[model samples]
Target: MKFVASLSAAAAALGALAMLPTTSAHGPETREEVVKFLDQQATAYHCAPAVAAYTAARKRSWAQKVLGGAPIADQNRFIDGYFEAKGLDGEVVKKGIKELEEEGKRIMACDPVVESKIRNSTCVLAPQSTEGPYYHTEAHPIRSNMAEWQLGLHFEMDVGVIDVETCEPVPNILVDLWHANATGHYAGHPEPAPHLRDEKPAASGLRRGLLSAYPRTNHVDTFLRGALPTDQNGVAHFVSTFPGYYTGRATHVHIKVHNEWSVLPNGSFTSGNLVHTGQFFFDDDLNESIDKLWPYNTNPIIALGRTRTRNWEDSLQIYQDAHDNGYMPTFDVEKIGGVLQDGLVGYITVGVNTSASYKPVWNPNSGRAGGVVEQKPIDKATHEEL
Candidate 1:
């Protein structure tokens, strides 16, 4: 009887081991790994009173030993607090609560949209990866509007920063953002992607290295990129065109969070700790709708009749931005007007551990953010422009 019990215990342990997620040295090599990691972090946030009593009541079950859990009215007030603290209009908070309650206890554990909304309200950690090849550190203007007369659908983004360790809003931190224009070209970089000009596909290896450092072209143009310090409420706003898709990736935006950063005399940020590097994506249905629009339809690569990669199809990187249960590195967008072309607004809350930092590599010869040009010839193989 003892031997039989030992064998069963061993079998059960192995089963649990098999259920754990596995990742490559580079990070989150599989979709399942990405989803599982996100779910775990989000679950941790909800289980603990990291931010508010609401989180505790959110997951409390009547069957649990603890009694007098927060009621639905309390939950509504908790949800309202976030918007009220942000100074948002009362109508918006009321509508947000209505929808949040409608979702009920299921929480749609795996749905990206639901997760995006939940994470936006609470301080949950965001994954730090996939800065992409086009990033030019310290080379973005400190301005609210990054559009610079670029032709595309207007987009306004409100990004909030929260220190996950304390579960509180973080102020004065620099948030830098960049993305492709309507025609699938990033401002300042001449090529859509490294060595993939003229409608050619980038190598799979290059796709995997989306977060790896690439040599900068040092181009002078700075459209579609901007930086700003978060306010006391830990929010920064920017106006830009909606991001268009590039080859080998989905429609996404790149973000970098900086701490102890200073603004340069040239109207750009200087030195700071790169605390978090991550990407945000739009839903595939939204992407498809935008692709039919004027300037986006004019993208030369897509004009060749090639289909762009969808969110799920870009298996390597998209999963890293998504959580299986709690968080998604995507925006909760709302139409500001009757149509998308009219205008759109999006909001995302970034959760970061202020104690952590990163040293990102970029082109040393890149031009300054304020229209100072330094042209250089890039070595295609090494992506090094010397």
Candidate 2:
């Protein structure tokens, strides 16, 4: 039997709402009014474009374990309302319903394909160390509060001519990405210690004098925002360090991809608008080292040593042969369980469009006090909505 990961009908519904008319003064309608309209549309199409069967399976498992019973109906209602509020109703709802039905039938018709487990052969045998103008210096203002050095890895996935419905590679897909820094820190304009200098006494490690403003060097803005072009083989490479793990969440990067059809309001192409959010994991040793420290130690998702590297290989140098002219590392997409493993590896193939199959696997606070998941509700208290 062929196994196919289900696509979220909510996504299709939301996509449709993006084409709807909004309310404005003499214009269409207010944001709230437009939101209400979409909600009604989504309600009308609720059952038609319900959540994917695969997603429902995972949720079913969780509900049974945690809720002691399957709240499938309640969950569906909540999801539908959430999508509706996001303005994904009407045409989008109809389209999503069709897509869901087609996907369900495909899964039911074929046996699932079993994927072979791949090994994470990459490792930082000798961790590279670099010195920075420490302690709020003019050049490197941010003081390192964490004991260990942190790294962040970013990925760009290219879905080469593979229609999700047909399971074939579609050429010329674009992926966009952004993420936090190694120290779980973010870099922004007018750095925190703009006035600090790097002339502190090394022996005493004490703050020296008023920091001087030096010309910014290596200002690549690694904090976030970058896109990569895929190769003929339908893969894109990113030169990034392993991202540090934080409290509550495991170590991972953020990524998104866009097809040719996705466009902006001005009829221009937008990058990474497909919206796929996923977290990547590292090897057992590195994870263990990270867990020994704070934040990650307390994080529930930081499962150390539980995940082992199946086929371990080391010392695969990138600059070994004359043909190696600083090309990006390469790995088989079918191998590594559809996710990038951690460490400074030269090449990785976590599978293109892995995020495309991604679904909300876990929700820490599903039915807690003051916890609610709406389609895209604006936080009235914060005046922020996503």
Number of the top candidate by lDDT? 1
The positional error of residue 376 in candidate 1, measured at the CA in angstroms, is 37
Evaluate model 1: give its lDDT: 0.57
| RMSD to the hidden true structure, all candidates | 13.0, 21.4
In TM-score terms, candidate 2 sits at 0.31
- Model 2 CA lDDT for position 167: 28
* Model 1 residue-pair collision total: 0
lDDT per residue, candidate 1, 156-216, as tens digits? 8878777765555576788899998887777666543465444344455425313223235
TM-score of each: 0.65, 0.31
lDDT of 2 at 84: 29
Go through the candidates in order and give each one's C-alpha lDDT.
0.57, 0.29
Backbone clashes for every candidate come to 0, 30
**TM-score, predicted candidate 1 vs. hidden true structure:** 0.65
